[model samples]
Target: MRAARLRRGLAMALTACSIVVTVAAAARSTVPGTPVPPRLPAMRAETLPARYAANHRFITESEHAARALGDEGRAGVLARLARGDRHFLSFSPRGDGQVVEVLGDLAHADRIAVVVPGSDTTVDTFDELGTVYASLNGGARSLHAEMRKLQPDRKTAVVAWYGYPAPRTMSRDIVTTDRALDGGRRLAGLVGDLRRVNAAAPVAVLCHSYGSVVCATALRRMDAPAESSLSDVVLFGSPGTGVRSRAELRTRVPVWAGRGATDWIEGVPHVSLDLLGAQIGFGTDPVAAPFGARLFPAGAGSHSDYLRPGGLPLRNIALIALGRGSEVSDD
Candidate 1:
């Protein structure tokens, strides 16, 4: 009886969301930034510096395209990305855009954190707010800085991986697992590549909101589990992970969940049901005991505050990345 009621509620919500999605898609039909043309080929370089140089050239070309389209704001963003200081493993100006930016030395880092952002992420809003350690790159820098402070002797790196076309916040796509599935396939490939590049480094994945769903799928699809480089998987302010429990993830590493006291996602319904021949909603609140994930303190942070500088959540995430999970504070 209770399950039936939950299904009915979810169906209603999905119906409403579908209508909104139609309107939003129509509105975006003539959007200014439709992916720039003349896509470049992927770099075949094995060295990190060569890969960075090739990606920088792509960014520069993308900036020119943005300027030609009269999008100064986007061009400006791309300009900064093409700078000599920035190191990108991948860059694409197609669709909503994608980037895999690395902070710190990737080749020699013994500790690495891969950050997967939530919905509404794109190249345009990549550095949104521009606050210290708030934007995508800033947050990566924050985590890297925190990890360095925790273990100055250990080499650390953070990858801000926006490798998929994240759905808009109000889109129906955000509510479903379609994007997450695609994102997971890509994420799984990335993890495989990372393992090949640095087989011994302890890697941690920090998934935020919808990214949790993506991370879960990646874990499910990954092969060669015994050689996995993943040391931890941390989900913060997540809606759901599309799984009932952490055991379903089949991960040997610790699965951690955390949510700030003031996070709005706490109110999202933690239920999944079949509706319209599709999976509606992600299942189980990850932080709940039923999910069987180790709970970590996130302090009083909102949905976007988990990676903010000086936040308790950021500190804990850093600790997890550094393989110092025991030092993570309960308070």
Candidate 2:
């Protein structure tokens, strides 16, 4: 009886070993013959940045942008931007995974408006904002579409510049601004590139939310003799542009500021130093501030509604783009 029990135990051990071997073989077979897919050659292990120890963060951010735009199939826009392809001229990368978009005509365009977006903005957000909020594509597509509708013969284009790493939340405004300086430098480079392409093109930068910070940093870095013909810099839903007052921004260019009555950003503190030793200051309310900027009327809603389709702020932007500044009416 004892001999029979020993034989049975040996048989069970052999079965268990066989099962383990089979599972190991199956796991090996599941791996691709080429571990890296041919399509995503740039995303291979060796090519990834050493700093991105959390490589998954890049993938997550890309997927978030893609899903936001409602285009699950083309979720690789941010990834592609990292690879330096301009297929998404509406979105291009400056560094890391930050993407920007340049719209309108590249040559001989009468007016150019660069729309800098804020937080959580990735290449994918462009599509999502366009798809979900048809009015909010920074009013970019709609603004351009309306321009075409109003005057088919006119030349105009809107650039969606997301050249900086935007804060995921308002709490990170300071952190976001720090990174935006780098983006601002890149934008200044783009300005040079644009001038080289067309010296006669009039340029304007429309900064929204935290984008105002990026524009402020860019303008600050410009020397007085620089040929950057940035005619107008408009800020909407701005927390602060790191200047005590609009005049302290030190640009010969006109600075435009506006905010909706219900906008939460109005509550943010607007305090910064000026070129002079004096403390140039902005108020809790941008509309009430002494900045030389022309305050336009923003309708009801939080900060995100300025560029909504059919909104007053967007119409004002369209007016600015068309060079009809006097036509802009206050809300």
- Taken over the whole model, the C-alpha lDDT of each candidate is 0.81, 0.57
What lDDT would candidate 1 get against the real structure? 0.81
Model 1 / residue 128 / CA error / Å:
1.8
Best by lDDT: 1
lDDT of 2 by residue, 1-331 (tens): 6455445434433332244223223323422221221222222224323213233344445455556756555456545334432222322222123444445555657777777776656545654554444222445666676656555787876666665655444232332245566767876765665565566767778888777877877787765433365767888888777665677667777777788779887654454423123222222334555656777666775787777777787777667766666777865
Model 2 misplaced stretches (Cα beyond 4 Å): 1-96, 129-131, 134-138, 170-176, 223-228, 271-285
Candidate 1 lDDT trough over 10 residues, lowest sum: 36-45
Give per-residue CA lDDT, model 1, range 144-230, as digits (tens): 888898889999889899997777777777778888999999998887777766777878999998999999999998887422789
Clashing pairs in 1: none
User: RMSD, each candidate, Å?
Assistant: 3.1, 19.2
Please report the TM-score between candidate 2 and the true structure: 0.66
Query: Considering every candidate listed, which one attains the maximal TM-score?
Result: 1
